[model samples]
Structures are given as structure tokens and as C-alpha cells.
Target: LFQKESHIPLPPKKDYDKVRAAIEDALDKDDYDDGSYGPVLVRLAWHASGSYDKASNTGGSNGATMRFDPERKFGANAGLEVARDLLEPIKKKFDWITYADLWTLAGAVAIEAMGGPTIPWRPGRSDKLENEGCPPDGRLPDGDKGAPHLRDIFYRMGFNDQEIVALSGAHALGRCHADRSGWINPWTNAPTTFSNAYFTELRDNKWTKKKWSGPPQYEDPTGTLMMLPTDMVLIWDKKFKPYVMKYAQDEESFFKDFAAAFSRLLELGVPFDEPGKPAPA
Candidate 1:
């Protein structure tokens, strides 16, 4: 019989705070690629939370099942274990918190460490039982497709055109891997540092088709960086081009919109307390 103790012994909130600090510190460690692990962490959070399907109301950040076997093997999940393994020490230190919360918080922390906004977060998500989790393989967006494909994937998760564009802004921080996604190079010169370069490059660069045997993509004239066809679709399509252009022109605007959209992405399908908590003030 389950019973609440009169003097309930809960773990100190400072322990959680300390765990968060440890993660923040780890963000600065130099063992990883590009001299920082921030991009992979952002990718980890997106892969974890991007599985939501509004119609079935199943498979989002609430479960955190990617820690397990089958979900970890997902095709879209390729290379993400790098991020998960990086956070293992922090996870062991704060085993009281769920993986769902830890992964998302790591992303929030990584953003701040890279000079981005502080994402507001709470700790109520509980780990799901194995049977209660595991999203299908194709839930994530494919970089090869265009605006219609982006709409199909994101709309399945109940996001609008603006939200889809805003969320794609996260590409600013990470590169496509040749081995993983068949595309390569950071989207911006400062991929490790958060900024609006992804948008700027989209607008300013003369992107010719990458002359590679790998899947079709674009590269700048200097041929140092790469962009997926999906990224170009933002400008190719009429509906999404304006926001793309704005972000290209204004870094602060992109950061503000990205923070709002990403905050919403993390909270998708998460139930809120009464008087829904505001993002960190």
C-alpha cells in the first residue's frame, strides 16, 4: 500500500540546481567536436521532443524513452547517443529527475551557455514505462524535402507555418553530418556560438548545388559550408520567405522568435499548471 510520509524526505532542490550547474559546466568542456557539445545537445532535444502527433496525442518529450533500446536505435536517432552519453554524469548525479526533463534542460542550458536565451523549464515530466513509449522512426523532418514536406511533418505535430519556420531556426547551431544525414558542414561559421547566421547565409550566400556524390545539397561559392535543400525551401517558398528574410537582416529578432518557438516546441503536449507558467523573466 502506497502511503505519503508525514515528514516526506524529498531530495534537496539545490541538488537539482547543482546538477544543472554541472551540465552548464560540461557545456564548456573541449573533448567534443567543434570544441563544444552544444549542437549535438540541441539535436538531442529536438529528436526527443519532435515525435509528437497531435491527433493520436502520443509520443513527445514527456516519455523520454530514448534512453531505452528500441527507441535509441531509431534511424532518426542516429548519432544522438553522443549527446545522451555526454549528459550521463549529470543524470547519475540527479537520478531523481526524469530523462525527459534532463534532455530538455540540457538543451536550455546549452542555449544559454552559447549566449542564447534562458528557456523556462519545470520538472514534472516522469519517465514513461517502456510499453508507454517509443515513437515511430519517421516522426522527424527530413532535410532533403521542401516546404510542403516541412509542413507535413511539423503540422502532424500541430505547429503552424510560422512555428515551423521559427523552429527550423535551430539549424543555426548544428551541422548536417555526412555519415548521419548525408549532408555535411556547419550551417554557419560560428555553429558553436548561437546566432542568426543560418538566416544570414541563406540570404547572402550564392549557393550552387554541391558537387558531391552524396544527396543533393547547396554550398557557398567558397565551398566551405553546406545547406540542405529543405533549408533553401524557406526562400524558395513564398509563405516562409518573409520570416527567413527578417531573421537574415536582424539577429536579435531571430533569437527572440527562436526562443519563443523553441520554448513552445519543448512544451508541446506538456500539461501546464493553472495560470500557465511564464517563460523565465
Candidate 2:
């Protein structure tokens, strides 16, 4: 997709490639979270695109509205401000790239750099003024709810049962921080890369209710991993269970579907001059 402003001129292809690489270079090294910034970067992209409203088409990554309040202040968006701040320098260097496109590209690139699918992406999203395009609360999924809730949330954004399963595969990469989402620990042994381990673990493990003071969640027998009630419901419910098994057994299948769903996600509400092209290599 072409940048909205013809006069401003899109960053030359080589320069755009440099900006993508620079996002990889800037990962935070602190131990509080994973040593890599991939997870949060993915979250930044997901949160940006996740806010799209199919009915009104108000949200999605087009406006980069999450930088402002309500969205920045929302409960589901906790810990995301860091992701926004992390991308600031990249924005400065390639001042032409909009936050909507930058955050989403950061996410897609982080997934690839951290050993995940190469999400097809492009730059077309334009920046919105402060508080100009913030989506209302409750667009993102909640960890405490079940399958019906997942359906309601994702379906609102035009995802099918299959795409919803594919997108949740992202959990394989990130951990829940006590200070942030109130849930603690990564879902997989390797929390730095994208894999179908989340699907396999959910399908294979004997998960019992986590005996803790925090919100209801599940822990595996070995105590090396955890799953949200929301995570487990995928296996428990018949409608969502088959896809769980499929992703667990086939990594390529997961990657392909995830790319399509996520790419479609980034484009929601975006009025691209050209509709269906993948990101530049």
C-alpha cells in the first residue's frame, strides 16, 4: 500500500528495511520480562489492530490512536505504553512512517526476528491527533472469560473460529507479568519465540486449577507453565478444540493461518490504495 501523502514520499525501500532492522536492535534487555522485546512489540501491534470495530470501522492500526488516553489507559492495555515508547526512536528516524503502520510492522518484524511467522505487512496507516480515534474499551480479549466470550470479541472484528485459534498462537511467545496483567509466568518454556507450543501444551498437559490468590488460572503438573481459563476453554469446548489439535500437530499450518489472520487484522478499517499486497522483504 502507498503512503497517504504523495508529496511526503514513502521511505525508500532500503530505508524501510533499515527501520525494520532497527526495531530488532532496540529490544529491552531487562530480566523483569523476556530478554527480548518481541513479545511486547507483538502486543503493541496486536493491541493497535485489535481495536478495530467492523460496524463503524473506527479503530484498527490506521490511526495509531492508542498513544492517547482511554486506549492507553485501558485495563487490557497495561504495560503497552512501554511498547509504544520503545518504538519512538524508530518513528524519529523514519519520521514519515505513521504510528499505525510502525507499531504493526514492529509487531510483525518482532515475530519473525524472534523465530516466528513472517507476517505480511505494509505501510498505509496514518497517524491520528491526540484522542482523535481511540476505540472504546472491551475490544480486546479477556483472560477470565470462556469460548463464547472469545467468539464475541474476535467475531466482532471479522475473525472466524479458525482465525481466532490462529491468533491465540501468539501466546506461545509472551509471559504474563504480575505487575501488568496480574497473571504471572510465560505459557511455554521458550517464551522468546513464536511456536505452536501453546496449542500442544494446552492439548497435552493435565492442567489443574492454579491454587493461588490471584484471578482464576491453570497450571500444569510440572509447575513449569500456566494457562488462563480463557486459554483452556479452547480445549474444553468442542467448537474450538479441533483447531487446537491441528495447530499442535502442524506448525506450518499454524504459521500460514496466523499470517493471513494477522495480516487481515492490520488492514481492518484501513483504506489502502492497494488492498492485498504483502510487506516488503
What TM-score does model 1 achieve against the real structure? 0.92
- Candidate 2 at residue 2, lDDT? 50
lDDT of each: 0.81, 0.87
Tell me, what's the RMSD of every candidate?
3.4, 4.6
Which residues of candidate 2, in runs, are more than 4 Å off?
1-14, 28-32, 278-281
lDDT (tens digit, per residue) of candidate 1 on 139-226:
8888888788899999998888777777777777868777776678888888888887888889898999988688889999888888
- Indicate the residue-level lDDT of 114 in model 1: 86
What number of clashing residue pairs does each candidate have, in the order they appear? Answer: 0, 0
* Worst 10-residue lDDT window, candidate 2: 1-10
Worst 10 residues of 1 by lDDT: 272-281
> In candidate 2, how many clashes are counted?
0
